[model samples]
Every structure is written in C-alpha cells, then in structure tokens.
Target chain A: MRVASALLISAVASGCSGNQSALDPHGAPAIHMEHLIIGIVAICTVIWVVVMVMLGVALLRGPRAAADTAKSEAWLAMTVVAAVAATVIIIAGLTIASFYTTRDIGVPKSDALTITVRGQQWWWQVFYAGADATPGFQTANEIHIPIGTDVHLRLESADVIHSFWVPSLAGKQDLVPGRSNSMLLRAEKPGVYRGQCAEFCGLQHSHMAIMVVAEAPADYDRWAASQRGDATMPADPDAAAGRGAFLAKPCAACHTIRGTAANGTTGPDLTHIGSRLTIAAGLAETTRGSLAAWIADPQTLKPGNNMPMVPLTSAELQNISAYMESLK
Target chain B: MGAQNRLTERTIANPAPAFVAGALLLLIGVGALLGWLRQPRELRLDPPAVADLDQFRRMPNGISGTPPESYFALGKPYETDAYNLSQGKRLYTWFDCATCHGDGRGGAGPSFLDGWWLYGPEMVSIVASIRDGRPHGMPAFRSRMTIEQIWQLAGYVQTIGSYTPKIAAPSRNDNEHTRPAENRGPAIILFDEGPLGAHPDQGPSP
Candidate 1:
C-alpha cells in the first residue's frame, strides 16, 4: 500500500509537468485551463468520497425500529438537499470557467502575425503572411514564432482532413478540405514544442507531425529574414553539380525551391529543407544520408505515400544531397 | 396450462422447418449475387495499336551510342487483358492525369484521340512525353510515378478512342492520391511488376 501510494503520487506529479503537456500550462491560455481542470478534479473527488461514505452507511446498517426508520427518512432528505446544493455549485463554477476560458482564448489581437498552415496528405505546407513592408515566403513542416506574441494560425487543407494541435501552445484546430479554420497561439517563453495531427487522416497519419519553435523576437526576426530570401547558392563544384542534378531530374516536378527552377506544387517546399529538424513528416532525422535514402526509395521509409522512388545514381545522389544540405 | 397450450399451438401453426428453409434460400441467393459481383471482369476488345514502332526504334538520337527505346523495353508492359486495362484505367484516374488531359480528349493538352502529334505519333514518343514531360505544359512524371505505373498509364492512354462509347476510369478528379479500389498495392511500385521477356529491344513480341 505504501508503494502504491508512492507510485500514485509520482504519477500525478509527472502528469502535471512536461514540455508537450497541456496540464503543465506553459502559456496563459493553457494555464487558465489548467486552473479550471484542477478545481473540477478537486470538487469531483470530494463529492465522490462523500457519496461513497453515504452508500457505505446505508449498506452496513440494515432495518431498524419505527423511531430509527423515521431518522433514516430524515437522513435521506438531508442527502437530497446536499446533492442539489453540490450540483448548483458545480454548475455555476463550470459556467464561469467556460466563459472565462473563451474570453481569454478567443480575443483577437490586431498586431498578431498570421501564418497560413495548409495540411496535405502527409505533410504541412507553411506560408508566412506578408505585410506592406515585408514580403511573405513559404516553408514546410516547421513554424517559428516570436515568444510572447499573439500568433494567428489560418489553417486549411490541400486534401482530406488534418488537425493542427500543439498541446503547449494552443488548442487543436481541424483543417478541412475546401474550408479554412483559424486559431490564435502565444508562447510564454523560448522553447521548442512538439505537435502532431490529432485527427486520423490516412495511412501515414501518425507520421504527420509538427514542430513549433518559439524564439526571442530578435532571433525570430533574423530567421524570418533569412527565409524570405532564396536558398543560398552553392559555393563548391560538387555542391553546384548537386544543384544541377536536382534541377535536371524530376525533383522539380513536385517540390519548389524558391529562386530556383525547381517549382512544382505537388510536394513540400524544400527551399529550407536542409535546415529542418526532421524529414518524411518527422519520421527521420534531417541529414544528408537520410535525404539520399528518402530520394532513393521513399516508400521504404513511408509506405502508401505519394512520393515516388526517384531513381538517382550514387554519385548524383551524393551531389544532390550535398546541394540540399547547402540550402541553408 | 391453457396459455401454454395456446402458445404451443401458435408455434406449431407457424412451423420452424418451413421458416428455416425460406431463410436458407434467401441467404443462398444473396451469396450468389455477391459472388457474381466480385468475379474478375474480362475484356473482349482489341488492344490499342501503334503505327511503325520499328522505324521509330531504328532512329538514333546520336548521343550515348544507344538508340532511344521505349520506357517499357519489354514490348508491352501489360497483356492488354481486361483485368490489366481496368487497372490501367484506375491508375489514370488515381494519378490525376485526367486533370489536364480531359480523360484523353485533351483540355490543356492536345487530344490523344485526334491522332495529332506535337512530339510524334509513335508509342515511344508517348512514353517519352510522360517520362520527360513536354516543356511549359505537362509536368515530368518520371520522379513522381514508377516505371510500371507509367507503362500502365501509357496503355490506358493508347486505348482512349479505340471504343466508340469509350472505356473510361471512374472520374475521381480530386487532388487526393486515392488508394486504387482494386488493391493492386501501393500507388507507387518500386519492384519490377513482372520479368522481362528476353528484352524486346532485339525485335517486336520476343
């Protein structure tokens, strides 16, 4: 029993904290929700224990005399009154929490930066909105936002259905085909939060993951500026050869690399693919070797995906992989 | 006792044997209909024809000392059988080839039924058009579609105008890469679909 109590306590402690946990409450919205959750749990637990005690009393003491029967009737009436009072209090508490949560999460900010996230079959296509002074650019899989800033996400799907969910940052929003949904998010501090498609989309639905990078305002500005430009040109011969090979082959057919001849919309944008943390929708690490193997046989890594096995010679693969890595 | 007797007499009037027999016959009919629907559909139509395939094969492109052969070096990739054509038709729709090609009558591109050639009238040219897509319009499918799939699509395109009523795939024209209903496996085939029959480069119908 001691060991069991220890285990229960540890589990509860661990549950209340994690980098990706909603209960941990990294930001204002999640923290607000966390308070309500804790209140509800405490209230429910107390009520449950009281009801169980009452049931035990009623079960243990059986029939009695006439005077005892009259006392039992009075006890029953008191229990009913307590139950009604508890119900009213619980209902009032929940109603206030719901309204407060909505008010905190739904209030839109005028200066919030809008990022359009389009969900595809097994990947994410991210596009940052351009303002009057700055031009917008396209990236994929990963999104970087400034810490403590209201980040508005305009979610849509190119095909099928997908849900964008980052437990630490905000609530889950469904991306339905032919329809656009919007949600707002704000990170309290600089950290990387993992996210995934909460909806069951298709075969590789499990592989459809997301990475949200919360950085300092200055760092985010620098990153955004870099992404706005074309992929840095390769300096060396082998790297240049890789670039040529990428353009010559059908790699351009489904992928787009800004400022390069490889513009095809069927696949993810690879302009900043080299800098991504993971590839194949977070299935593999983003490395030159992984990229080569992915190009050689994508189906082997992610089955039932639309990416065909690109037939490339070893030397060509090496060069192309090098060029891809040099995109940063 | 009276209630029990009445219940027993009613049950006797209804009769379990006749009711069971009727239900059994109904089940048999349903099973037969399902079997008929699931049967493999076969084709009785002639395969699409190509004019002067030999002449096109003989012409050298001057580079690499190797003559430009068809993508499917093994004569015909499929047997042009009913089952194969039906799969090919489904693949055509699966790959969204109908989006620009108008199911073969041509939309953004030229009509395959008109027999007019922007590149050439040979079968190799058609395969080449798909392999390395034509400039400006057709997207290069070499990297996106497997070789066998390309062959299947080519076969389906060849049979476009052969029938008056038109042998067509079900139009699922959406951008979704739908799983083929026939369970022919993944949309992409990495391994060889079948063994080559002695490398048809030597002659036709090896």
Candidate 2:
C-alpha cells in the first residue's frame, strides 16, 4: 500500500511537471479535461490488474476440477459484451460532454470588442474597429488586448492561408483566403504571450511571430488612440533630404506613410513604423542597424520576398533610416 | 475419507458458486454503467445532415484559377551595345542584385552568365520578367523602370546570359567562330530613356 501510494504521487508529480506551458491548469476547461483523463486511466488500470490476476490463478489451478464449461462460456460472453458496450458508451459520453462545454464557451456577442486580423505572406496585419464602429487603428505583428475583457477576432488572409494561434490565450483558428473566421479570447492576467503562423505560406513563414500584450484597460486605450493618430515627420534638414529621397525613389511606390504623399498600398503602412517591435514581418529585431540592413537588402535577410532592393548610397541610406526611426 | 468427501460434495452442491458467478456478472454490469456515466456528452450546436452519397460527390476543389497569359507578358524586348553593357554593369552594382545573385555568378537565383533558362532563354521572357514578374518573390518592375529601359536592360542581361569567357590557352580560340554572340560584346544599345521620359521634369531626352 505504501509503494502504491508512492507510485501514485510520483505519477501525478511527473504529470504536473511535464506541462510547462499550461498556465491555466486550475481553469475550468483544463481542469475538467485533466479530471476526465485521470478517472478513465485509474479505472482501466484497476480492471486490467484484476483480470490479469484472475487469469493467472485460473491457469495455475489447471482443469483437474469440474470444468463447468457452459457456465465459463456464459461468463466469457458476458465479459466481452460488457467491455464493448462500456467502450462505446464512454466514447459517446466524452464526445457529447466536450461539445456542450465548447458551446457554453461560445463567443460572447454583448459588449465584445471586434478586431480584424489579416495574415499576409510573412506578417500579421491587425485592425481594431473603433468605438463608433468605424475602421480604427492599424498595426502589425503585435496585438494588444485589455486584461479581463472578451475580444473577438475576425481572421482573414490577404494572400494565402494562415492560422492565428496564441496558445496562452486561446486555441488556433485558421485565416483562410477570401473568408473570415471568428475566435474569442480573454486573458485573465497581464503579460506578453507569443504567437506564430501555424500555417505554411511561403519563405519567411517560420519567422512570422506575433506578440500579444495583455495590458490594463487604460493602457490599451492610450495605445490604440496613439496608433490611430497621424504620423509626425521630422523637420530637420537631413530628415527633409531623406524624405525627398523617399518620395523620389521607389519607397513611396509600395509603402504608405499616412500623413505624407507616400500612399502606395502594396506594403504595410509605415506611418507609425518607429513604434513597431520588429521589422520584415517579425523576421528581424527592429533597430536602426537591422532596419537599415533590411531596407538595403531585404532579399538577403528574407529570401523570396516581394520587396525589391532599391538603390541607395550609404549616406542616403543612413538618412532615410534615421528619418524612419524618428517617426515614433 | 468418506466424511471428507461428503463435506466437499455438500459444499459444491450449495449456492456458493452460483452466488459468486451472479455477483461477478452484477459487478460487470455496474462497471459498464459507471463507464457510461463517466463518458462526456457531446452537444453539437449544428446537427450534421444525414450522410448521403450525393453530398460526398458535390464537394468542389477550391484552388485559384490559372493566371492570365497577358499578365505574364507585359514588357517589350531590349537591345544593348558594348558601351551600354558596361554602364549596365555599374547600374547592376548600385541595384544590389550581386548580394544574392553573387558577382556575375548567381547564388540565390540562377547565374546570369549560365545559358540554362528556368523561365525562358529568349530576351522577351527576361524583359517580361523584369517588367511584370514571377510568382515566388519577384517584384514587378513596371512601376520602378520605364518599358524601354527594361528592354535595354534585358538586352544587357542577354549579353551576359550568353557569355562564356575564352580559356587561358590560345588553342581554345580555334573554335571562336562557333561561339555564340553572347560570348562576344553586346551587338547594339537599345536605350530609350525609360518611361519616366513622359514626366516633364525627368522625361527621356530626344
């Protein structure tokens, strides 16, 4: 009995230790799943041991005693039938229970915030629908949500199929091309949770990562408001020269900087580019050096990307990079 | 011995075995009931339609249709002379194709000097590619460069595309007559100051 107790304790300890990423073990859904699994396993283990012991005793005793063949046959038939029936009943019950649980946790419609997530080849474009229900602030790679609030995401794909998955917050749902799928997520605590593109799109797909920052309601509101506001271009002479180069070159042909005349929509908006955490759709760390390197040769860093290498002298490249960094 | 045998017979004749068998059967029935009770109840919000052969047959492949041929054939051909080829070489350096394609020998893309054509060996295909684009990651150059300049650039590319340098040994020159035009310098310069010529500020010179 002591050995059995020790074994049981060890088993549970190992199970608890094994799941490192299970932040919500005490949460209702996770707890329910764990309880069901443990119960089934325990019952099955007891049955197996009892049956094996009985079979061993029978074999050792031999057929010297009266056979009672008919009675034995009846028992065997009953066991087989009972096992099959039990299996079917268990499977059906589990399926039904899971379905109901999922339904009860269905997306909350009342006062739910709606955000549109568009997946491109190697990036995530996030758009928040404003309080008035108009198209609101747009950002990339990072998604901010208020803690303890239900947020609904309408997932869509711009070019190919991609999946939005932030394991700490909710389960994965695909963003299919030309169609929108909905998901509801609510985080209980304030922290940064990581997400990745679950679907294979193209080159740099593996590099696509997103950050979900769960913030206080006030902080989230401030961030959203700031993103919605116009971009501020620097008035310094070098920056002005850089701006000229940006407009004169092919930069304006693809990227859109909202308050300026650079309004080509082929690439992500760079109005608030200085505030973004990463560049090249989360492929590289957003810094002066990395950003300049990316601008100089995007294909070298992310092979098989749509952005071409624009010709720029070293000094001009520096000026343009500095100007972009000043936008925050 | 007679008494012992009678005792054993009496024990066997009693309801002991029957009681044990009945209890076992009852236990199994109870176990099965418990198992059934423990199973999860599936609540499907949307009940599935009854399975039918017709439903299976109606499924359609939802892939995108093939791209149009005109979309692929957007640019005209270019012709380059030796002087323009030299200038193009300098322009190519400024453009940074060498970073990925290597110094004349290709790395990420096929070598410019190699005759093997992944798309097409002809100058028209090259020009179209420079102007329109390829599927994987090639950006369309129509917005970036003029149509005529792209053609001339294609001509310069062709020159490099067909070139094979002569070996160090003079004996290799014996087959010079059989060598392709790409092996020699560019034939002619097909420069048209590119499409920007339409802009009064930066239009092509007469």
Candidate 3:
C-alpha cells in the first residue's frame, strides 16, 4: 500500500513543476499563460461538476409523462435559455483574455538587446550584437541575458523550419527560411531556462536543445566582454600542437577559430567554444572527454547530423579536445 | 428507449465484419506511412549515378563539342528527388564550391544564376566542368571526389541556373552566410551582377 501510494503521488505531481514544464512560469509571458490556463481549467471544472449533478438529478427523477403541464414546459425553456447565454458569455470572456495576453507579451523596441539566432540542422548558432561600439561575437547552443532586461531575438533558419520554444521564458516561435521572425525573451529571475527545437526537422532534431543563461547585469557584461575578445593562445604544448593539426586538416575549411587562419564558415564558429555550457546542442556537457567523444564519432552519437567523421589519430583527437577546452 | 436498446444489442452480436474492415484500413494506412518513414538518411542515388559514367561522354558546348542527346537524361532521375537534391546540396558545401562561386553568384568563378550557360545546362557539361576543370582558374576536382559524388554535385549545379524554380530544388541555410550558400533559396533568386568569365564563343540559351 505504501509503495503504490508513493508511485501515485509522484506521477500526479510530475508535470506540476520542472525546468522545462510550462506550468512552472518564471517570466512575464509564461505567468500570463499560467493565469489563463488556471482560469480556464477552474471554470471548466465548475461547469463539469454542475453538469454531472444535473444529469444525475434528471436520471433519478425518471422520464417525464407524455402530457406535460404548461408551467413545466416554460421552466425547461427558461433553463435552456440561461445555459446558452452563460456559455456565450463565458466563451467571449475567455477569448478577450487570450487576445490581450498574446498582444501584451512584449513589444520589442530598437533599444532592446538584439541577438540573432540561426537554427541549423541540429544546433543553434547565436550571435550577440555589440552594445554601443563594443563589437559583437558568436557562440553556439547557448545564449546569455541579464535578468530584468528585454531580449529581442531575430530568428532565422539555415535549412529547414524549426521552432524556438522555451517554456519558462516565452511562447514558441518558428524560424522560417528566406525570411526573418522575431520574438521577445525575458526572465524575472536569474536561472537557466531550457529550450529546444519544437519542430520535426530531420533526424537529429531531438538533440537540438539550447539553454538561456540569465544572470546579473554585471555578470552578463563581464561574460560578454570576455566573449568579444579573440581566443587565447594555449599555454599547454599539447594544445598548441592540436591547434596546428586543426588548421592543417579539413576542420579549418568548415569552422572558424578567430585570430587564426581557420576561417571556414561551413560549421559553427569555435572562437569561444570552451566557454559554452554544453557541446553539440546539449547532447552532452562541456568536458574534455565529451568533446573528444563527439569529435571522434558525431554520426554515431547523433545519427544523421551533418558532422562527418574526419579520421583523427588518438593523440590528435586528445590535443584538439584539450585545445577546445582551453579556449575559455 | 426500447428501440435504441435493441439497436445496441444487434451491434454487440455482429461486430466482426465492421471490425475486420476497420482493421484492414488502418493496416493499409500504417503500411504507407512506414514506407515513407523508412527512407534512410544515407546517400541512395550514388550507385546508379556511378553506373551512368560508362556511357558518359561530354562536349561542353551544345555544338560539335556536346555529347549525344542521351546526356540530358543523366540528371533526370535526381532532378525531382528531394532526397537526392538535398544530398547534392550538402556535397556542394563540403567541397567549398563557394570559394570562387560566391554562393553560385560567381565572384572569381563564373556565375550559375545568370541563366547564361557557357556550356548549356546539361548534367554532362556540369560534370565535365567539375571533374576536368574549366578555364580561368577552375581547379579539377577529379582527384578529390568520386564519380557518383560529382554527378550529384552536377545535378545540384544545373538547378542553380534554372529560370523556373523546380519543386525539387534544394534548400539552404537561412543566414547571411560567410561564403557560397547556393541552396539558400528554394530556387535561384537570379541577379546578373557576378563577374563573367570571358567565354567569347558562348552559345544561345538551350
């Protein structure tokens, strides 16, 4: 009995709160959504109970006789009229509430911090626009924002359609090819909000996750300043040799490592790759081991992704992963 | 009430015919869905494309230099296959065709969007250009790519110059890309601005 009740309680509360659950609202837009959800569900529950009770009463009273009184018929007509009126009024109120909530989510102005997000096969390429004359920089799979600030995201796709949805921050918006779409992302508290590509975009879509890091203004500024600079030269001898190997191989032709000759644009820029929280769009945490594993065999870990396995010696692989980790 | 009760009793007594028919319909729908979903994410058009090379002869221009009329059909099988076209698109990126082509706009290399073919938009000609290399610094990719891969690239290249967008034309990344992104649009958004190589003996549009 104890085990069965424990299982039941866990199941019941599983979706009530979590990192990715819509029910756990942390931003203004989501709070509005939560309000609407609670209001609608509460109203519907009350109506359902009343309906069931009325149904039971009618069944208990039995079927009416063939010759009904005029007074009884009049009462039945009045009850139906009241029910129809109530339904229309309730639906109209809900519609009005929804309309206002959607419109009031956020209207981004030119002054808001603008970030351009490009959805690739199974990852996100994020570019942070510079403030004043600070100069912008790019990162993959991670976005950083200051709490209590309005973030304007210019969403675009590199290939197919993908939707950006962070249930804790904002509603879902699609990134369509050949055109640009915009969305407002904001947070009331400092925390990491998880997001993912909510569209069916080919084979590795399930692994296309992103994280929005909300921090204090001073912390965000410091982080952005560090990102704005080029990658630091590695102090370790192994990492320096790994850099030489990376530029010598085909990796240079597809990726760009700033302050170096690796200016290829076929893949994500690895300028500040070490600073990112996760690699391969949240496939794994950012670690030397995970980076080496991903580099050695991308097609196996995330099957059908565009990263083809380039044959690497164990030593070269080690040096490169170390070099990547040292970029921070 | 009595009539409705009798109707419910009749359905409960004879359920097999309706159930069997419903099951068969559901099975057929599932079978079709499975067929589509089973398309592997690997290259499937490469083998036959390699087989075509035995008869593959090419004259770059449509005149005496052009190959026989059968050469036109080399790109037919892949022209409308979305899967094959997308594969060719990927190869276009991996090979760094944009270094000179500039997203097929022809910066250092001749443009593919002008609808003006130095050689006509034949798969054979495109393959020859890729494998054997063309004039004015066009490097030969013969040593770099397989015959099958070359054909796939050729098919994608031919579509870049098409005036009417083929429904099967490959799609590209949606970004202000650093280099050649030929498949950026569903079809060629043509502009006659890229640098043209001096092909003094160019023929009319075929």
The regions of model 2 sitting more than 4 angstroms off are: A1-66, A131-135, A235-240, B1-206
Most accurate candidate by DockQ: 1
CAPRI-style class, candidate 2: incorrect
Compared with the true structure, what per-residue lDDT tens digits does model 2 show for residues A154-266? 99997679998775566668999878898877666777766788888876788788877778899988878788887776887776677777777778866778778887655
Evaluation by TM-score, superior candidate among 2 and 3: 3
Model 1 segments beyond 4 Å from truth? A1-17, A68-75, B1-100, B103-105, B108-129, B132-149, B152-206
Q: Which residue pairs in candidate 1 collide?
A: none
For model 1, state the Cα shift of residue B19 in Å: 8.8
Worst 10 residues of 3 chain A by lDDT: A303-312
Candidate 1, residues A1-328, lDDT tens digits: the string is: 9999999999988865667788766666667777777887888898899889978997899766666778888998998998799899888988998788867876357578989999987989999988889899898889999988888888999868899988887777899999888888888999988789999988789999888899999999999999988887799788899998888876786788888988877788889888888888888888889988888667667876767555677999899988887888
DockQ agreement of candidate 3 with the native complex: 0.10
What TM-score number comes out for model 1?
0.73
How many backbone clashes can be found in candidate 1? 0
In model 3, state the lDDT of residue B64.
24
In model 3, state the lDDT of residue A8: 95
The candidates' DockQ values read 0.16, 0.04, 0.10
RMSD (Cα, Å) for all candidates, in order, is 10.0, 23.6, 9.0
